[model samples]
Target: MRPGVSLRTKIYGLVITIAVIAFACSLWLSIDNTRTYLNEQMQSHAQDTATSLGLSISPYMDGNSPMVVETMVAAIFDSGYYLSMVLTDADGRELLTLENPVEIDGVPAWFIRYFPIQAPTQLTDINNGWQMTGQLAVTSNPGSSHDKLWRNARNNGYLSVFIGGVALALAHLILSSVLLPLHQLEQQAMAVTHKQFATITPLPSTRELNTVTQAMNSMVTNLQTSFTQMAMHAEKLSSDAFIDPLTKLGNRRAFENQFIAQVGEMQDNDLATLGLIQLPSLQVINAKLGYEAGNGYIRQASEVISQALAHRTSGTLYRTGGSCFFFKVASAGATVEELCNHLHEQFSALYSSHYSEGFANIIATSYDNKQQLNPLVSQLDNLLTRESSTTGTGLVYWAPEQESQLQHANGLHQWGEIIDDLLASNQVTFMFQPVLACEGNQTSENVLYFELFSQFLQDGIPLANSELYAMAELLNKSLELDKMLLQQLLTIGDFKRDVTVALNITHQTVHSAEFGEWLEEFYQHNASNLPTLVLEISETAILASIDSSIRFIQQVKACGIQVCIERFGSSFTSFKYLRGLDVDYLKIDGSYISDLDENPGNTHVIQAASQVGHGVGVKVLATHVENETSLRLLEELACDGVQGNFIQPTKKLAPYSEKKQCQYWPI
Candidate 1:
């Protein structure tokens, strides 16, 4: 793009040009008219002097009064108006002569050279008693006339310049006032590009500019309305698929998704605690006081547990069944026994106040490490039922073994030290999983990019990447960990030259100003050797600090990096917020893609997500496509890409050379 001159400057130039020309013409005309008038007056004065002196000299025409004539001529010449005078006899012989040199003061020599004044001479015949004796000539000096014209021209020039300067300054002020609205309109348009809509207030009074301002305001209003509607529709679809309608919590589907993604796979020495709350008197309460009463009880219980979970960031509450609520908290916080006991106290208070004869129960259990999702929930349910049958409600119980408690504490302590060492060492291991494009009926040979997963090792044992992040977050080491991951990824020369790579970033990293500044500098220095880098942020992380995340995404994208929102649709946060984001891809959470062929509800959710993404010109991708049916389903739903075991399992990222191209999955 070429540089543009401002309207103000252009107008100023035009006004100045016109003013200069007009002033020059006006000054020239004034000086010309004054000079003509001065010449006429000088001529009239010289003629009058000559005629009067001729009569006076006529008496001396016979040579007897020559002295008198000479005296009169000399007296007139001495008046400084006439340059010279001569008296002659009737026979044309010279009689008396008077002459004076012409000189002018207070005017420049150059001015005289450029503008010369013309002088007129007058002649009369001298007569004595009706006889012509001699002739008299009177010539005017042009020095005084030139001096007068120069003074007038100089004064007029000064006045014109002062007036022109004042006019220009006033014109500048007027132009700035007139174009103020245009500047506002420009800023408004730029704001819209960043998804910030601002309207102009106190509209400009100019007819044309006012019309334009109104039009811009109307257009912004329409866009904001449309963007809001699109977001709301997408959010509704997300809620329908995963949210429990009555309790406003995660439904069974949401719970299953959360379990598989976060809880199903656990690390050694990491505790997994599950809590189940059952409203045992729900049916009896409904029979006596109606379903509304039963709903009230359920809502009350959900509220109690919701409030308890609020104090713990890692806790997740779900309405897994009609009368059963499930929750999970991180291992580093309050033990399972304390949580269960506290809930029991709350439940006991509710039972005493609302249902004097009815009862409720709470049961919980903790495993030392990873366990099957179904068996764990079933075991908790069986324990709750056995307790209710034996003790008859109002009971709070837990699994007998508390061995996981000590192991979890020890593991947390070990993790803190290990994470500090890893951060200090500035190293990490990376595994690459390919995200391949989805083309209908054809196995796509094209690899969209490779997503990187980071892991930490302790004494040759691979620790859970998820737990490491959890611990890092707890210890405020998330920023350091993310930095190490990016630094390590950049060392792989093969990926930089041949393909793209996507790396996950934590919420802490996304919000940290230090991290943002570091990333910007890193990209600037390594841009040439950098791959088509894509930063993958979780859907929840963005929703947590939406404004900052948007800034971060925009900042990185300006540096030529791509962004993806991974684990999308897992959170019930309205998808409307996506309209405000500038993203390249939306990686649908694996839970939604896992049973795509069987889960009809998730199909609608994914379809809505795909439509929303495409609406904003972003590609939608499905994660964890483990089977042919799911892959076919995703393709039918218009998913642009897919990633999971169906394509290829994650493998260690190895160093490569320029001669050998990186291997891709089978087409």
Candidate 2:
């Protein structure tokens, strides 16, 4: 049979086994000791009783009756020590008999069976005179001994249970205390594996556990630092791979990625519009003014284009090539013609006045249908070639009829081939627009304000600024353009007087540490001769690189240069950023100022902006003031200055006193 076992049963069995073995040895020893002592007492009691009875019976045998012997025996039995007593004659026949009984208390039969103790009886023979006449016998009761044995056994069993329980409780408490730290360590390891990097502040109680925790913390800290560094390096590499180093604008690779994504989205959603603009005379301009001016034009154009597209809630602009650019727009069901007209008006007005003679030849092509981009691009090429044959005047949209001509023009890739030649020649030129002060207390202190502008030279003639910038962006030479423009401005020595000349700074240039270092060197060389220069930055550019822009501004300020925020209100909610930047001027966007008199909304906006600017200690300059009325309104609103067609056209740099002496319009 399988061994019978249960927790209680096993415990009982073990206890019983141990107890039985112990009790057997103990009982044997105790019983031997008890037997020896009890026997001696019993023998002594028997001898005493027998001797007394014999002495009394001897009198009876000599002269008394049998009753007298019986009385003596009864007296001895009544003493309670003997179980039985007998008196006999010389022939050993019973003469008198007596019996003794004893009662046991406080003991069970089981106790007695578990630990039975017995004492042997003793017998003695007595003789009258010389012969044995009778036998005397005495027996002792063991009730007291049995009761004592039972009580001792029960006490031992209880003691055994108490000792086992105490041992179990102590064992459990010790085990838990020893293993608790290991459990905590396991949890911390899991957290680190999941990138939590949580610290273990509570040290383990044991020295070995504390050592392990310290080692883990050190390893995790190192790994976390390394991982962060690796991630930053990877991000830098990825950005470099897809960005144009010069323009800091998205390059052809970036354009392609965006183009594919937009096209796929448009195809799936059927809600987007695509537009492309190609600057036809970029090469000619780059050739005339040098690559630096060419790059300046591109940077300027990119900023303007980006600003224009941003006005539309959901549109993105991309520099696709040296002379080509792309845009994606969510039309919100607006007609292509309406969009095109709006773009045409904005581009024409902005570029014509700044670029002079070169504005007339630039072209913009747009495609709105999701299924017609390829055909549209082809048609645009044809239109460009046809226009080139003629005067290259105004904008053109692709029509179905141009398909045949597009096929013919497909073989001509002249635009790309001329770029290198154009860059090799110094064909770019810089221009300036005067930002006239509108305040009534005007003094001829030669405090003339001007904004930087650029153009591309074509066939010894200038190309429009927009066209040049678009081309530079496409060629991935925006930084080069900016550098060239700055060089040309310095070469012209227009900033010799105590005037403020504002130059546009791109986010790409501002973010580049190398560019910053180069700028420091340039300023060091021109420190004594430099005018009170003001660097103008767009809100969009600032938002894109807030930290770098702030750092650049600080560096420029350290060089004694002023910083202004251009197109300030274009980013409607970006005014909050002004609190963090140290800016001297806020140039209000022309869009909000164009119809200020007619549009209460526009007037309210300008008024509110003026208050905000003055509140923050920044001077406000209103742009695109077209007539006497707008100028008067700007002055009424306490605008610090104004710049527009209505203001005096920018003249060649003259002595500081002479330029400030002439007032184009009397306020």
Candidate 3:
């Protein structure tokens, strides 16, 4: 029964048990002493009474005065101390006797029965001039003695009970103070195991308990530090293991991990796809452009591919080799045809613009119908081999005619026509999401600016910007589309003054060296009418070719326009480029923002990234800050800015107004 009792209860119980035993002993001694002393007193009283009554009667015995002796007995009995008095002659003849039953008042009968007080009886001879006449016996009544015994025992018992109760209460109070620290220690241990890393302050006054608690605080601090470092190192190991050494894209090994993991998780009602884009001309490009230039071009092309597929949260891109890239998309937003077209449109033009003769091919395979990845991978292998041999120069979207690559050129032409029609309209839509300052900049005056999210209108509906960028790549009009968006922004008359807006740019816009030269000349003419503009790209884009990204960043920064990498850590990023690239901000991926507080894995990663970013003078901001809890946690992690629904809702794309009288604010 006591097994489930708490430690505090057990401590109090032990103290109470000892107190009860001591109380019992003390009460018994008090009762026993009172009884013994009472019994001796009673015996003395009986002897004195018998001797006095016998001497008084001896005078009467000498004269044979029976009436006098009887009178004397009556006097003694009426005194109320004796129970009875008896008398007899020398020859043993019966004599007159006086007796009465003794009854003590107030004391209970049961008490007397349990703790009986037996008084001694005494006998004396009544003598006449040295001759014995008769004997008298006197027995003292024990009623008074019994009453005193019970009163003494009960008073001592009551005192013992009161003292025991007080002692138990005091012991419990003391134990509570002593064991309070133990309760805290238990809680602290549980919290530490869960990675909370909490500490207990104000050590217990008990010397031993204080020492233990202090030690615990030190241990918990060390353990928390160790856990955080371990998490960072583990994340680093996973990332470094999966990333390509040169391009920083997911390596072949990473692709295999994602492939198998997705295959195991794919359900019958799942949408998963595989794609492979191979640059069969990497060696030729390297020979034409130096090996370093060739590696840079590969990285640039990878950036375009990654940006095109950024809409897929569960998909991954891998640089299988210097000339080949592979991707396995999960829960694709578009069809296999659309993916192939997008990849082709983005990378083919990018390759052509970089090398003397551009060459790239794309093959997209749908794995939803296939039950396993092994067969899908085999199919991709066959397509790559076929593309390397005789596939047409442009995009080969998977068509009904599987054996021939050019059989799908007709579909590609149709997509090209759609993109042509969309661009001809010249209408662009733009959205704004405020990048809230994390370091106490709340008011409009303190806000840095809103990030401008722009898209091209197609079929009377605004498609995502990546779609437009991808299509523009295939049509060789991506630079024209980017310029058109900037032209529309420059023409905005109602845009608030003293407020800056940042634009997220595409890889194709900057891949062509001619675009950088063109932008440098175009800005000289248009910089006067443009608002404060900050162009943004993804880390994947910059990592593609640092040389190109750096050249483009410097060209734009020279025009008084800043550059940033949005969704920063989604790809494999290296800090070495920070020294060369002049980026103003690094926006962390949203995936990490949503998981903070609940799991410190993202926190540790963000902390490590921010530390590095800060050391290089680049401000770190987090995107997708959902709630106050997440926002507060990011603040604690020392982020410079945050953007999400919690910070500000994204505004609808406002159409460009051409009529209002306005001078575009100074860039």
Model 3 accuracy (lDDT, Cα): 0.68
**lDDT winner:** 1
- RMSD for all candidates, in order, please: 8.0, 28.6, 25.0
How badly does each model clash, as a count of residue pairs?
2, 21, 2
> What is residue 580's positional error in candidate 1, in angstroms?
4.0
Instruction: lDDT for model 2, please.
Output: 0.59
Which model scores highest in TM-score? 1
lDDT of 1 at 470: 62
Tens digits of per-residue lDDT for model 2 on 309-416?
654434566676686766665432223334556666665665643353333222334332255455755665667567656565544443333223221121113333
Q: Which residue segments of model 2 deviate by more than 4 Å? A: 1-424, 440-448, 494-496, 650-667
- What lDDT score is found at residue 91 in candidate 2? 68
TM-score of structure candidate 2? 0.39
- Candidates in order, TM-scores: namely 0.67, 0.39, 0.44
Of 2 and 3, the candidate ahead on TM-score is: 3
Q: Point out where model 3 deviates above 4 Å.
A: 1-10, 62-68, 92-114, 190-196, 243-255, 264-667
Model 2: residue 554 alpha-carbon error in angstroms: 1.6
lDDT tens digits by residue: candidate 3, 18-37: 78778877887787788889
